[model samples]
Every structure is written in structure tokens, then in C-alpha cells.
Target: MTGAEAVGSGNLVMGRCVIAGKSACVLYDSKATHSFVSESYVQRLGLPVCELQCDLVVSTPASGLELEVILGMDWLSANRILIVCCEKSLLFPNSEEPELLSSHDVMKELQNGAQCFLIFTHLVVEGEGMICVIPVVQEFEDVK
Candidate 1:
């Protein structure tokens, strides 16, 4: 699904998975055509990325998604996995013995400081007007 759809649905299946021996937040998005990894997460983990032959464009209507990796249909199809949304589990039909990966609600995990906050502002421009925008970050302590 598009980032906008995922945000609107609010029923995203999220879980913790180990990548390269490091734990990371993983999103199982069935509607997404291809998988993606957050640039910040990759850089932080020093993971190697190979150049793709073709360019891919991603549109996140509302930015600041805190997910570390998104497992899209590409990965799911390759593994012949079935997503049991109601049970919040993944069924691996291709495995010699069917295996299931169950996931718990991620709200508790996110509460432990893995949250991302987005700030939005409105800008007005007149006819044929040009505007320059800069981003500033401020840190605050004891913000409830």
C-alpha cells in the first residue's frame, strides 16, 4: 500500500525482526510493490546497499515514518508467505512444515523512545512568488 494508505488505515502490522544480527522495526505491508529500508536506519547500522538498475520513487504523503524496514509484496511473494491479519501472524506455506511468525502490538515498543514527531506549517505565496524554506531542529527536555 502507499504510505498515505498505510497512515490512513492505521492497521499496519509491525514487528521486531533481526537484520544482520541487529534488531529492527519491520512493517509488513501487503499492498506495497517493493520493499524499502529507511536511509537513516541503514546508515546507522552501516549496512551495504547496492545500486539498483532502475530508479524507484517513493511517496509518503505524511513524512516522518519511524519504521526501520518495510517488507512489501515482493518479499512476501518470493517466500510464499500468507499474512493472517486477524491473527497478526505470517504463515510460511513453502516451509517443509508450515511455520507461523506471530507479532505483538508495537505500541509498547514505540513508547520506549522510538517515536518520530512531524511538524507541519502553512506557507502562503502570491502570484509568481518564490520562497525558500529551511528546517530547524530543537531539543527539549521534560516534554510530556
Candidate 2:
């Protein structure tokens, strides 16, 4: 998308969400099994921190990180919702690989803090493979 277009409609799944009475830009990841809040933001807002049963080491371009307050399975179950995913209404929100993660249950495991990081995943461009993880939070307006 062009810079102007991105500034205009924004991208898929980007929307306004209220976290701890503050306006937070939230992105809905259909693949993400957990919802995460920024640790620093949490600290700033003084949100309650709860101990997890285990640590959550996440894979990212920066190697790895262990989080503290991951709003995972419980959060998703609590917020059973389907807000906005993509801009186009013609496109279906559900994935074509419905059975892929049906019984999979957990798609990601994070101990607690999921402030934000980049993970390198494979993408095909004209039959050629590319390694990239676009940091949309930095690109979008007021995503903190």
C-alpha cells in the first residue's frame, strides 16, 4: 500500500480498544490464541500482575523474551468477540485452514509480558522466499 493509503484507511485488523480506561490501539490476530498487554504500559497504568503457572519464552527476531502478564487463553475466552479484522467486508474473517488449528488449542505460548516484538516468518514473492516481519505498531498511528 502507498503511504497515503496507509495513512488513510490503515491496514487490516487495526482498531481502537480501551485498555485500563486508556485508549489503546489493538490488533486482532485470528492466529493469536492470547491477548497481550505491554508491560511498560501495564506498569504505567499500574495494572494488577498475576503469577503464571510457567514462563513464556517467545521467538522473535531479537532472539527471545520472557513475559510476565500474558492475557492468553483466559483473556480470549473472556472476550469472545469478532471485531474488525480486515477493511474489506467481502473478505471472510475465518481462515481457509480451519482444521489446521481447530484441535491445536494453543497457537502461541508467552509467560507474561508481550510488549511487542518481531518474528521472522517465510513469505513467497514471485516464487522466491523472503524473510520479513513488519512492525506495524511503529507504522500505525497511536498504537501504544
Mark the regions of model 2 whose C-alpha exceeds 4 Å error after superposition: 1-12, 59-77, 83-144
| Cα-based lDDT for every prediction | 0.73, 0.47
Distance from true position, residue 72, model 2, in Å? 6.9
Q: What would the TM-scores of all predictions be?
A: 0.53, 0.38
Best by lDDT: 1
Backbone clash pairs for candidate 1 read: 1-31, 1-32
- Which candidate achieves the best TM-score against the true structure? 1
lDDT of 2 at 77: 52
Which lDDT tens digits does candidate 1 get at residues 38-132? 88879978989989899878764225456888899999999888898897778766347633322333454456664333344666778887777
